[model samples]
Structures are given as C-alpha cells and as structure tokens.
Target: MFKNGVFYYYTVLSILFCLLSCNSDSSKPFEDFFNTTVSTEKELGYAVEIEKIALDHIESSSYIGEIGYLKDNIAFVDYRFCWVFLFDYEGNLIDKKIGHGKGPNELFIGRISGFSFLSNGQSLFHEASNRVFVFDNNWKKIKETRINWKGSQKYGKARNIKRPSAKEPIIYSPDFGNLKFKNFNKKCYFPIYSEHSNFNGLMGGYKYYKEGRILAELDLSNYSDINILRLLGRRTPELLNYSYLPHHSTFNFDIDSKGFFYIAHEIDSLIYVYDHDFNIKYAFGVEGENMDTNYKELKKHDVKKFRELFFNDRPKRGYYSDIKVFESNDQNLLVFRSYRKSISSAYDGLQIYKNKKLIVDTEVPKGFEVKYYKNGFYYSNGTIEEEEEKISFYKLKLYHSVF
Candidate 1:
C-alpha cells in the first residue's frame, strides 16, 4: 500500500511539472516545430542577363528614392531628398528642377516615399504620411489634401510628436519602392504607419500588436476620405518568438495587371493575395533555404534593448524583403526577394513564381531586384557609387527553356 501511494504521488508531480514547462514556453506555436526551407529544383537552370545604363548628367546623392514612370519614354528618379532627376528611355537628361522649397512648384519637405502616375496627366506622391500631393505633368504642385484616417495622429512637426523613448525609431514605414504605391481604376494605395507601431511591436502581449494595420487607400473620387486596409501583420507565429524590429515588421505590396494585390510581410513567408476590394482571396509563398529564426526575444517593453538587438543581431539575419509581380510575354511572374543575412555577402533569395507556381527558387545577386520590366526585359538599378558620377542599372532577362 505504501509503495503504491508513493508512485501515485510522483506521477501527479510529474504532470504538474510538464504543465508548467509548457506554459512558460508558450511563445512557440505549432508551426515553430517545423523549420521549413526551400531550394530550387535540381532540373531548373537560371541566368541573369546583365545590362548597364549610363547617365549623361551629374548625379547627386547615392540615396535613390522611388522611381516614377510618366510615359513609355519618360521616367524620373527621386534623387535624394532635394531633387527629382527626369530622364527619357534613351537616358537623356530632361530636367533637374523641382525640389524642397517654399515656392509654388516646390515642397516644404520633398521626400518621395512612394509615387503613382495618374492617367489624367497628374502625379501622386506619398511621403509615408497621411497627406497626398498631386501635381501636373509639368511638376507643379496642384493640391495637397490630408487623408481622413481616424485614430491617426497628425505628424505635423518632429519636435512636437512624442516618442516612446529617446534614440528609438521616430516612425516605422514600409512603403519604399514604386511597387508599393499602387493605382487601380479610381483608387490608389500607399503604405502608412501604425501609430507607434515600433513600440507596440515590442509589446507582443498587447492587443494592438496582434491587430496592427499597415496599408491605406486614397479614393480619387473622394480624395479626403481614405480607408485603412485590414490588419496586415497579424501575429505571424514565428515572429512571436523573437523581438520584432520595426523594420522586420514592415511589408511591401504590389498589384498585378489582373488587379490582384499581393502583400509580403518582412517576417512571413506567406504572400497574401487580395482582390480589388481588398478581400483576402488567398495566400501563397516559399521560404528561403537556411533562413534564420532564432532571434532574441524581448519580453519586456524596453526600447533600448530592442534597439540594441536590432543593431547588433538584425544585420546577420535573413528575412523576407518585398514582393513584386509583373507580366512578361503573356506569362505572369511573381518574385519575392529576401535578404541572405550574411553581412559581408551579396546573395539575396529570389523566388520566381510563374502563374502562381514557383519555377525558380534560386539565389541571385544581392539587391538584384526587378526595377522595371519593359519589352521582354527587366531593369534594376546597379549599386550606386558615391564617387562615380554616372548612375548604372542592370537589365535582367530570365531564360525559361531549361525549366
């Protein structure tokens, strides 16, 4: 009788111990059990056709903002924060005017976070803020209207705004390239912040972090009124285990010719596809080989610790960067770019999906993004040289006869 009683007591203690362990380690969900990795099929063969475009005029800073195409022959590059360099398809310098100024044509603070060319001979620019600027084809500012986004604070002056802590990210915005600034029939979309998203992201236990909304739309019919897209960065399970940096929490969006919108969050492998109405139609994705997820988790809402983790460890880690979809020769191609995470390496993951089926899951040149696709060719800016005057770009062509 005594032996049986001791055995039952030990079994009860063991069960309690198991329950405690599971509760303490609740951050890792079921998906965390599988470290999924993807690689190109052995039979697939890919090549990058390199083409460099030279500029005739002098270039300014190395910072290249979003590039906007006004026509088949006209293009403009947002040069740094002060100027917009306009050129043609043949690389002819057209204009170097229109920048930060108090003039009628100039902006008080000229920053092109994203842009979309309108069909009615006008251009729209979003500075990652609530306001949208409209200008004529001549680059003269026509009107600037503040969007009607409720629960959004006005980013009036830098000094007036409150910060979560000193030396932290002032704002977290992901609408970087032209791909992110999309235009459909009567509505246009741009990436905006989640009002203290960076700080909120650190507090993973809160409800706001689980329900963060990142994208917003501007209706040309009613320019003042705008609607924020659905909650984007939903608690992607893998991200829960680590300290979510503001940048890693960012995402990019693009719209295909079929009017299907695609969003790729930085920390997720799933590419969310939405119809014109912004409804979640489906999700498809492919993760990189040897992607790292073992990041330091910040349980406390400490801004200093989060900054230290981002600066020290974020560089050596790989994460999804952006997604872009384009059509080539009657074929629809979707590409997802990811950082290889090697601080000294130049290899980024480029997964090419042809018609929703991944045909090429291979590594390509670092920063080898498809800038613009035209006439059966894809173009991307080459690494900018601070000392070299002429700007260069790489024209990439993917051969599919092997696959």
Candidate 2:
C-alpha cells in the first residue's frame, strides 16, 4: 500500500506538469526571457554619447565592396581591381594595398570575398574559396587552412527548388559566399546553409536544412604548431520551425577576453552565453522596446510572391542586425544592433550591456554600425549610400554615469 501511494504521487505531479505545458503559449519559441544567473535592471542616467558626421561619395560606388576598420586606417575592397585598398582615417585614399590578385592564377588571392586586420595588428587575412589566407603586415602569406564545411548539403533537385521573385539586395544578395568575420581574427563564425541555398534562402516540404548546423566555428590559429579542433554547433532542434525563416537564420556572436562565447539569434530575444567549447552556459536578454516579432511563415511561392513577401516583411518588421564585444573601464561590454518599427529615423537601435547587465538601449546617428573599437571609443563605417556623392565615418562613445 505504501509503494502504491508513492507511485501515485509522482504520476499526479507529472500530469500537472504536462497540463501546464500544454496550456502554455506554444506559438513562439521563447515567450519569456532566459536569465540563469544574470539580472535585467535598466539603470537610469546612462545615455549613448554620439557624435555626428556626413557622407558625400568620394569615388564611384563600384569601389565599395567589403569594408573594415584598421587601428589607424580603413580598408575597402576596390572591385575595379578586385583588391583591398587601405585608406587614411580622413577617408582619403592611400597607396597601401593588401591583395592585388583578381583570379585563381593570382599570387595570393582568388575570387576574393573579404579581408581584415587581425586583433594582433601584425597580420592581415582574407577569405577565398573556403580558405583563409593569413598575411603579415609586410604582405607575406603565412597560413592557409581550408574550412571543412560538413553541414552544406543539396536539398531537392535544382528544378524542384523554388526561386525568389525579388531582384538583387532585397530578394537575394549573392555576395554571401565568404564567411562572416566581424571582429575576431583568431576565430570566426558562419551560418549553415543548404547546398541549394542559392534558391532564395528557403522553400517548402523539407524536413531539415543542413543537418541543423546553425553555427560553425573556424579556429584560425596554430598554437605552438598545434591546430585546435574546429567546433560545430549543431544545436538547432529549436530552430527547425524557424530554421530557414527569412531574415532570421543569420546569427551574431562574439568571444570575449575571458574566452566565453556570446550569441544572439535574429528571431529570438534571448542572448545565449557559451563556454569555449560551445557549451551553453546561460542566456540573458530583454526584448527591445516597441519591436515587431510576428514573422511570416514559409509558403511555396514562386518568384513574384516571394519578392512581395520579402519586401513587405523586411523593413517594417524588426530583427537583430549584428553584435560586438568590447572592454570598457575594466568591465566587459556587449553592444548589438537592432531594427525597430517604432523608430522613424534611419539609425538602427543599439543595446549596451556593461558587465553582462544592460545599462542603456538607444539609437545613435545613421551609419553608426560599429566596425572598430579603439582607446575606449567605438568606431563605425557609418551608413553611407554608394550612390551618394560622398561619405564620412564617425566615432561612437558610450557614457555611463553610474559606472
């Protein structure tokens, strides 16, 4: 009789738990915030200190390709020559060129995608054909490692996959061949995609995409001639529903000086914290004020319908754009860019987290997407239209009164 009572008690408890879950809101992935040891308290009196600037296109828009902020200079991939152009801080062109090759037969570069000066400031690196080419400041090739991408797979046959109706930049941007190398040079994070990814981001009747490898890491370092094993984050069981959702698959991440990884997905509000091995530690983030999260579902649409859906949902809706990490006043800082429907200005909204706690969330001037951080100041390449006659970049600095 005593054993029967114990079993009954546990069964009753499980029934109650299941009922609660079923009654809960299942429409969204995370209806509540995830704060494991973190707290969310908006400290007043902290404001985003901003300085303004203007842009009047200096050269033909074609010169604009990939842009990066070096410590003292700015680098641009001049497509005319298919090489990198390092310019002075004043936006004036400089003679310093990094890679000069245009095709596979060139010396060091082939089908160039992007390049940046590493954090060490002594070496430069560029991506081409799934390989990273590291170069010394004097422009000498030092290391080349081919990324073993095990997640890309062909979906249906080419004829079976659907294509978008929209034109360039809106319905599709084919320039995504290179991996995303935001700030970290020692490591980089890239998204997983279907081999038929060129078929306009997503289609219908697919069970999964790319084995759910949402994020993959490339250890672009060799410590004492020892190569660290690459990390593949296949943690995407929660993503299959929204896996190929438009404008939300791309994830943003950063590795702090402590070696902990911080990742923010486009559709979700939670910011996940992970250890060096990519094990999720905890997550903490509050949704931005006056944001839109009602994303459109996928339908088997041809090009025209796809274009209409994409344009209608892209700008009016809200999503996180990019994230960056910095060290300020001996405290770690995390800043991420977000788009909001409530804001009328063209400037993107940014949330600042000091020491893993949010202090301020506000918008800066247009073109303030941070590209470089130096001497306690955050710098950006600024939002400049290539068609505009000229352009200029501004430096951003955040001020906290409490800290």
Candidate 3:
C-alpha cells in the first residue's frame, strides 16, 4: 500500500512538468521562425577536392599564425620566425621583413598576435608587448603606436582592432571579454555591454559587419539561451536587438552578407537559417546522420562523475566544438568541428549551399585548422613534421558538385 502511494505521487509530478513545458512561450518563437524546410532525403548537389600547396620555404622552427590575402594575389602569412611573410601566388617567398625588436623598422617585441588588413597596401598588428604596429605591402614597418590603457581598463590588454563601418574614425578592440571602441582622441565601452553586465562573457568570436550589424559569440554559463548578442551602432549600440533561446545545447552562428544568420546546434545534425529580425527562414539537416550519438553516451554516465570530469579535467564524450560560415557571391559555406569520443583529434565537416539546396557534405582533412576562405579555396595551418619543429600551411581548392 505504501509503494503504490509513492508511485502515484511521482506520476502526478511528471504530468505537471510536461504541461508546463508544452505551454511555454519559448516554444512559439521556434515554430513561427521557420518559413520553409528542406528535406535531407534529397541528394547532395556539390563535390569537393582539396589540392595541397606546400610552403616548403618556411622554416621548420617558425609557427604560422593566420593567413591574409590581398586582391593582387599576395598572401600575408604570419610566421613566428618573428616576422610576417609575404608570398606570391605561386607559393614563392617574395619579401619577409617585419622584424622583431624594439628599434625602428622592426615589429614590436613578443609573438605576432594577429594581422589586420587596412585599405590599399597597409596592415596592422598588435603584439604581446601591447603595442600596435603598422606595415605596408612591401613588408615595411610604417608606424608603431602605444595603446593608452587608462582608468579601470588597464587590467586587460587590447588584442585586435575592428575598423569602423561608418564615417566615424572609431575602432573596436576585444579587451579581455568586453568590447572597447576608440579613436585617436578618446575611448569608451560598448553601451549594451555597459548596461547588461552578465552578457560579458569571455568573448570567443565577433564580427562587425556593414551598417553597424554586430554579432558577438560569448562563453557564458547562464541559461539555455543562445550565447549570442546582436547589436547595432558604433559609439552606442542602441539599434535592433534580439536573442534566441538555445533550448538544448550551446551552438555557433554566423551572419552573411545579406544579414541572414546560419546556426547549428552541437548535438543535432539540423542547421537553421534566420533572418535579421530573428525569424527562422528555413531549416535542413543531414540525412541518416546521427550528430547526437556521443551526447546520448554522456547521459548513460553518472551525473556526478560527469560533472567532476568536465570541471576538473575534461569531459568523457565527444561534442561539437565550433561552427563557421562563409558567404561568397554565388554560394554559402558552413563548417563545423566535432571532438571524437576517446580520441584526441577532431572531425571537421564542410557543407555548401546554393540556390536554397544542400550541395556539399565533405570532410576537411585531418590536422589542418581551416581559418578563412578566399576566392574558391580555403586556408589552413598544420605541422608537416611530428617533432613539432616544422609547420606547413595549405590552400584547399573546392570542386563544384554535379549531383
């Protein structure tokens, strides 16, 4: 008699929980956001082939950072050899200068943080020394400017600068986890981040698009809401703003030239497209693919043990790590990386979409980390030798699919 009473009490709680979840307002936003859907039963419409171009001349001891390209076909590769390398279209080293030192004609001390392409033949970089250096197309050092970290902002160093989209001369820097915009005269914090404190998680990836459309991805342990914030404006971000609920797992999203957003959840194979107003445009997924296979395995383990391992060391299961999107004149590309269970390596996949149809579902080669896209190819970095003494940079070519 006592056992029967316990079972009845638990049954009533479960039914109430379901009723509350089904009546939530968050469910409506997801349903109304989608206008169209593409069935994965359709055949893939694109093919891909990678052609590896070897930078054999780069020293084995040098580490390659990110690769930047010029319209004239010049590739500016950041080499940890303490300088930036300039390469021609044929992979031949043209001129490598950007020295490492404290003197004139030399880059600032410490490793090359990153390189930014300024207009014409100019580029900029900020190094570990917290100084910004400017370079020309000829590998010549144009100027070095010291960042003035004043007031309460002196704790974090500014890493990179985002050029302004409007007539304002202000540029933004990822200061630790916060956004700081400055010009030659004064500096200030982005207004939204100033007003909302919790949204300031250590910023992971950010894009400042044209007309003040800002997409910022952060790492926060808050609720299930998607960890992205959309802001519009320069000096103060006070324009169109909206955030969607993740509802399940943490994911990544990117904006295209047309202001459409492409988002993919970590555990599901489905990819969603949303408009600038946060309405779902369409959704598609890979047919017969189980992207959540590892997530299910995680559920079988003890909850306490899983939490211990995740916080103290590392999680015991594989999960989606990142997602990236690239928009070109005729096509859009989506790339996602997943950590494989019981393995140290990750699995990378690239999908291409054209004319509202899925085309490519191919794997990126192991070892190389794809960074950016240009023309019809992608750029990646890896080590050519196992001894950690040498590194190799590659350019990948894409083959259009016929199916």
Predicted structure with the largest TM-score when compared to the true one: 1
* 112 Cα displacement, candidate 2 (Å): 3.3
In order, the Cα lDDT scores of the candidates are 0.58, 0.54, 0.44
Stretches of model 3 off by over 4 angstroms after superposition? 1-43, 72-81, 118-121, 128-131, 141-347, 367-388, 393-397, 400-403
Candidate 3, residues 1-403, lDDT tens digits: the string is: 8999999999999999887655432233323433467556444655766667655455533554545566554444453546656676556776666566676677546566555554345665655454666667776776665544232222322222232222111222333221221111111112122101111111112222113222232211222221223232211111112121111123445456565666554444566676655456677766322222433223222445544544543333434433446656556545433222323435445555454456665565544445557766776644455355344566666664563
Tell me how far the alpha carbon of residue 49 in candidate 3 is from the true structure, in angstroms, after superposition.
1.4
lDDT of 2 by residue, 327-383 (tens): 656565665554453335465577877655677777655334666777766777645
Better model by TM-score, 1 or 3? 1
In model 2, residue pairs whose N, Cα or C atoms come closer than 3 Å (at least 3 residues apart or on different chains), thus clashing, are 55-390, 55-391, 56-389, 56-390, 56-391, 57-389, 57-390, 165-303, 367-382, 367-383
Per-residue error for 331 in candidate 1, Å, reads: 5.9
Q: How many clashes in each structure?
A: 0, 10, 4
Tell me the TM-score of each prediction against the true structure.
Answer: 0.72, 0.69, 0.52
Give me the overall lDDT of model 2. 0.54
RMSD of each predicted structure: 12.6, 10.0, 16.3
Clashing residue pairs for model 3: 33-280, 46-359, 46-401, 47-401
Candidate 2 has what TM-score?
A: 0.69
Local error of candidate 1 at residue 268 (angstroms): 2.2
Q: Alpha-carbon error at 153 in model 2, in Å?
A: 10
